[model samples]
Target chain A: MKQIVFQHHPGNVSSIVRGILNRLVIISFLFGSLASISFAQAENEVLSIKSPWIREAPPGIPTLAAYMEITNITESPISIIGVSSSIAKMTELHEVKLENEVMKMRKMADITLNSGQTLELKAGGSHVMLMGVQESFKQGAEIEIIFELKDLPAVKVMVPVKKDS
Target chain B: MNSILLKTLTIILGLIALGFGFWLAINQQRNTGPLISEEVGIVYPQAREIGDFQLVDFDGQPIDQQRFKDKWWLVYFGFTFCPDACPMALNDMKKIKVLFDEKIAQQVDFAFISVDPARDTPDRLKQYVQYFDPDFLAATGEMSDLQELATRVGVVFVVPENPENQNYVVDHSTFMLLWNPQVNLQAIFKAPHKPEDVVKGVKKIIAAF
Candidate 1:
């Protein structure tokens, strides 16, 4: 009985290498696709509020000042037309301006936010005026504020009141 | 081979260098003038001089320019209804008062002037300041009289239309003016001011005097 010895062909060896390479590419593609999907979900779930801070008011006074950074990441620019909170009976956009050497705080109609830009509301500058507060704003308390944007969806932010700088 | 041309070029370059040196010196001097003095025990810009004014305190007592003579006074303007910045400033001033030495404390006084005269009556002013520091004095007068005093001290106070309405608020300056015994406005401290800075500034002024 004559038994033929098995012979390895160069073409078959090249084919095996090609198949392994194709498997690696597919695995890498799958990983990359999943990573991008998770990243997108994180961005979508991010809270809309930015840099929310509060300053203390006097005793027996129900008014307080709240400041924050409002950023627009959407494709089109948006405006923060107003703010509302159940804690305060009235919430308004207030801006501090210097006229004739006097610092005047006035109610602003709206705060404009350009796409990919940020609008900062700070002390002695632009701020959110919280009037007729239903309760005292205790330090370390989380307050929820609802922002109504011009064209985009309304955003809600939980801001913690701080006592120190 | 061209000695004359080379000399001319060198001279032109030297002149340009000299001009640049002069510009640099002037710019540095302007920028550093305020900070250098403050760091080296020099008087602050706000406390360099004093202004003249006449007004009444919360008790309707006459507090003319003379009230500042021979003593140091921390004077700020606000109303009883002020919600945020005013109270913060007052509380900071109270801390400064406590930081002073007994001797300096005797020589120093804290005064709060009412920019909203219509509502900040003598009683209201008294009650408001007493809440912060019982030793602190509160003052108020006619709107025009308050404006006159405010102008002298480089302060501004404006009443919004229908400010009497419970929903409306008045806007006023956040600066605290320092006055000497001569009742002259010597220095001004900007708002969001810290108590430490104020204490240091007051000690320097007292030492200088």
Candidate 2:
């Protein structure tokens, strides 16, 4: 019935009105997509990674450690649930705890970073453990890792492989 | 009267000997202060001796306690698969060596003993430790031998009962043990050791001995 009324309408005003309505719909769709793209970028920027590097281990070694300083740039706190990388068969967040003088490596559930707080994943501390490394990462090589954040999009970083000085 | 005088002379000589012995002990105590004073590290008044163990070095050569003789050693126990604690300890060992003078550095050496012998082979240990420092001595032995060595040194370690899983992590003591030239444990630098404390503690222990 609405289509019939529009087709039978006598005035040119209705056609112009329809044209304007169609243009408005298209414009709104475009703006919606653009807003989502910017939102995704903002999510990626929530955690800032500084001086990200992977410790270059000896050849044929099956395990490696990646260290970095991660700061929450947003006003809200962010939590990292896990990490992944193509450089190894498995990637996990691990921490070295000295219990009764014994060094025990424990898996972490989530790493929480409050607003404006920096969390250091360093040696003899928390680190991203890459196990079953397929190939030896030589010095100056770059490896890509993805940090999975809770309730947010994952952040990807390119970490350089360097010998511990 | 002659007998009485002879007895008195013997008693006087005995008293003089006792006084000399007491004086000598006091002088020794004053000369040797403490093995390690204050917050450096833990140093036992008497050095503990380590038992014999059959282990292989990075070069695939069999090594026993004799390998530790004639040089000061900063010994660390861990595995090659351990990324965080193990490598950091090895790096600290390197830094401790740098803190020593060239002459003292010559007399001092570092040892990386892997408790996870099932995974860390002799060849792999060589590359792992030498990657940090070329002069690092790496070794691993059977689990029983390693356990015995750990017991002697007052440290403990637990290897995976079934290490077939390639991702198994071994738990081991992280403290750096300072061994004298006689292969005896003289001091222990606890975990998160600073290179300066290790150097200072070693020097103090070496001087005392």
Against the unseen true structure, what C-alpha lDDT does each candidate score? 0.73, 0.85
Question: Runs in model 2 with CA error above 4 Å?
Answer: A1-36, A75-77, A112-118, B1-39
Residue-wise lDDT of candidate 1 within A75-136, one digit each (tens)?
66677777988888888888877564356777887767666777778765777887877576
Estimate, for each residue in B1-209, the C-alpha lDDT of model 1 and write its tens digit.
59999999999999999999999999998755553133222244445444555667778787766766777899888876655667777888888898888988999999998887766767767767886789998887777878877777678777875654455677787887788777767667776677877787777667665
- Candidate 2 lDDT, B61-139, residue by residue in tens: 8889999999989999988998877887888898988899877888899999999877888889988888888999999
Best candidate per TM-score, number? Answer: 2
Q: Look at candidate 2 and give me any clashing residue pairs.
A: none
Location of the lowest summed lDDT over 10 successive residues in candidate 2 chain B: B32-41
Model 1 bad stretches (over 4 Å): A1-47, A98-101, B1-70, B98-102, B121-131, B192-194
Using Cα atoms, each model's DockQ against the true complex is 0.21, 0.53
Compared with the true structure, model 2 gives a TM-score of: 0.79
